[model samples]
Target: MKECPQQNLIVDYVFRELDTKTKTEFEAHLKSCQSCQQQLREFKAAAPVFQKARRIHHPKRPAQNYYKTLKENFYPSMSLAQRIHEWAADFFLTPSIAMRVAQAVAMLVVGVFLGRFLFFQEPIPVAVKNETSPILAANVSDQFLRHYLQETEMILLDVANTNPAEDRQILSSVKQLAIYRQLMQKTILCREHAEELNDDVLANLINEIELILLDLCNTEDENLIETLQNVRRQIKDSHILLEINSVESRGI
Candidate 1:
């Protein structure tokens, strides 16, 4: 005999989970459904045995009602942030392997962010006429732009050489994005310095590199090949690598 669709609802009915209308519909169906009826009867008959076994294996233990003892003082009024802070402090104070690992990770993350914030500010504007010599300022600018160009050239070369068809795993690589972000941050600082020095050539080159990096970072996996091809074309047509080498050789 075929099983009734409502057979599964028998458990819900026994546990009083169904609402009134659905419960009534299930009951009316139960009167005419012999298979569901027999199954329900068997389940009800076996429930007492299962409960007895559960009680034997896992008897209840008596415990103190600390909340009742503390009464109104059980939960002190505190802001959500304060409560969360206290809870986190209590949880990490516990001596467990997972807690120790989590605390270490949290500290490491905080340290990394703090270090970046402290060290990665934009290059300080050189005091051209007042404090530093013109030659010294020029050398600083040259070193800054030279370093930026070298790093940008390296990243571009890597992207240009990547064959999406052969190296499919490049789509999921984490180091690529990390390098992109690092270069992008440096580019922002470089652009600021370029503008300060009024070097249009260096500023324009920085702009182009920034756009390429932004595109590379935002490209979706499906369009990664196309984006890479476009970036290579931009780099080649602009003679970016040749320009970088020329700038570096001439001391920017």
Candidate 2:
């Protein structure tokens, strides 16, 4: 007897709707066809949840007019059956937008509960002004030194995975990193010496420079090497500015 066409057998084989003889023949064909094997995997993954959703019973079908009203109001572009299928699929696939919205609301509620339980509150503001003394500046400089060391250690720890050529590029950028670290220290020292001088502006600038250094340290793309060089030049300019200011103040 002539064998049945593969396309004719696909849907029946997928749903296990075939008789013993047909199923045996289909299995024989499936073993040799990679495409059919992948299709079977997708169908197997989707089938159980679809079967469970089909088992759920409602009292009765809604009125045609009610469905018409809903379709007109919310889903003018989709048919009623498509909308129902979408809702059922989303219910089974937990990462759907509806599930995300519910998760967000639940998190917000938990955050409020924790705030009440822990008695947590906002931070107090610190005042700053110019004419700060050197002693306070030195303390601020120490804090910056500690931060720079921590960041440098993190970068060095990951150095083994870096390409030799890339490492050389990153090494050239080290002078920029050094300058940034020095500026951070000086900014801290200035803040300590002049309690009335706010450090927020300088701190933000230093943070931007730190982010560039971090990118250079972490990235492996050859295309990004040029961009890192450009950022190094910018950092050098900032360091020069700091040096010029320090010199002028000292009458150098």
Candidate 3:
């Protein structure tokens, strides 16, 4: 029979399924013929996917004697030179244990520095003027009064932006805004009282209330009228907190 054509042999040769003689002949033909060489390249590219598919569909099973043969072939003896080489490699190439110790020491130093900076620093004392001092009292009252005026302006601006058609929502937002304004005014009055008594605690409380008013004025959400009302209630509650603190501070 005549020899099989080279083009058919290309696929078999690409997949390594050709006999030795046929493979030899196919490679020789591939060297001489550019078309056969190109065909071989194309077949080589397409053969891997088919090989993978065959492996997936028909996986090979291990022989029963594989582990027994493996154990029998295992070498237990080592030459002196080989042993020395292994020891030398482990000593030179393995990572140093001291590196871990150094890292831990570094972290401890950083932690101690941060703790000292955060907790042990002394708070500077605030200077307090005499009770019933007119100048200092006037300054504290003016500070909180400015805060109250700013809060009132913000509330008025918010109300101006509300739609009159949505009367319920507008009224709710306006009522909450009014309550916050009243709280802000009360905070200003409290500042005057604090300045008259020369009480640091009351001054701090007034300052905190002004901050709360600023926060409420800055809050923006047409849908959060209820949440805003809660904030207003919180500001009202601050007054009660101030009263309780004032009574406690007087030793009564």
Candidate 4:
């Protein structure tokens, strides 16, 4: 089947990521394209399956006390070499086929537990640490700042391309508003770090972004279009998107 260029937007549409104008355009395309319609139907059909899979309860593992007992009984009775020899002989030379298979399975399970007890250490929660720390604060790297800028750019594009006439909900969207609040808070955190760096230009740009986010979050529905237009103009005149791209490329 010939592919439609608009098919790529189907995921965004299903996820409600597309801004109003792009979503309206894609919906129009969806009406005309059989392939995209079928794909969308498939996506909808698969949603319940995924939800059910997520809710599935997995079988619980043996308790720690079970392992403790296994360790006490299995490892302390003999020397390591004697245990290995006995295990090997029991596994390979057992006259009963069922007994040999049981021994093999037990050995496999025991080895896995033994290896875990010997070498497994709890992993450091790096992502948690990064998230809790301010961007570029202390030992945190500049990657979080780059990621924040990229997300801001995407939100800005969504705001810029929104059609005021058709997408009256653009400025009032609950999801978008929530995202704006989050980004604004993150921007404030980033501003403190930016000030510490002593780079006036970087600090000023972040300040501008914070101001834009504030306006976006606080604009009244009655003045939505005017606010959107002003925002688009501000973004274009300042070339903020280009600056974001440049900063992303040249690391802080």
State which candidate has the highest TM-score: 4
Error of 1 at 53 (Å): 54
**Model 1 TM-score, all chains together:** 0.43
Q: Model 4: which ten-residue window has the lowest total lDDT?
A: 132-141
Candidate 4, residues 1-252, lDDT tens digits: the string is: 788777888888988999999999999989999999999999878876887889766554747777778889886578889989998887577647888678788989999999999999975443444456443345334666677888999998887788777887756766567678778877876777778777677788898898889889877688888988888898888888887787777778
Candidate 1, residue 153: Cα displacement in angstroms equals: 0.8
Estimate the TM-score for candidate 4: 0.44
**Each model's total of backbone clashes:** 0, 11, 0, 0
Give me the candidate number with maximum lDDT. 4
Q: Which portions of model 4 miss their true places by more than 4 Å?
A: 1-141
Instruction: Quantify how close model 3 is to the true structure by its C-alpha RMSD in Å.
Output: 15.1
| Model 3 lDDT tens row, 1-252 | 233366887766766799998888777877878777777677788878777787655334565567567666895467899999988776556636886566678889999999998889653321121122223334445455445444544553444344434544545454465556555556767676777768776577567657756556445465456545554566466553444345444531
lDDT, candidates in the order shown? 0.76, 0.55, 0.59, 0.79
- Residue-level error in angstroms, candidate 4, position 68: 99
Model 3: colliding residue pairs: none
Which window of ten consecutive residues has the lowest lDDT sum in model 1?
126-135
Q: After superposition, how far is residue 1 of candidate 1 from its true place, in Å?
A: 58
Tens digit per residue, CA lDDT, model 2, 62-155 = 6777888988899788778999988878765757787888878999999999988799664331111122322344355434534543443334
lDDT preference between candidates 1 and 3, better one: 1
Model 3 residue 21 distance off true place after TM-score fit, in angstroms: 22
Put the candidates in lDDT order, highest first.
4, 1, 3, 2
Query: Any runs in candidate 3 off by more than 4 Å, and if so which?
Result: 5-138, 142-147, 155-226, 229-252
Runs of candidate 2 exceeding 4 Å displacement: 1-198, 237-252
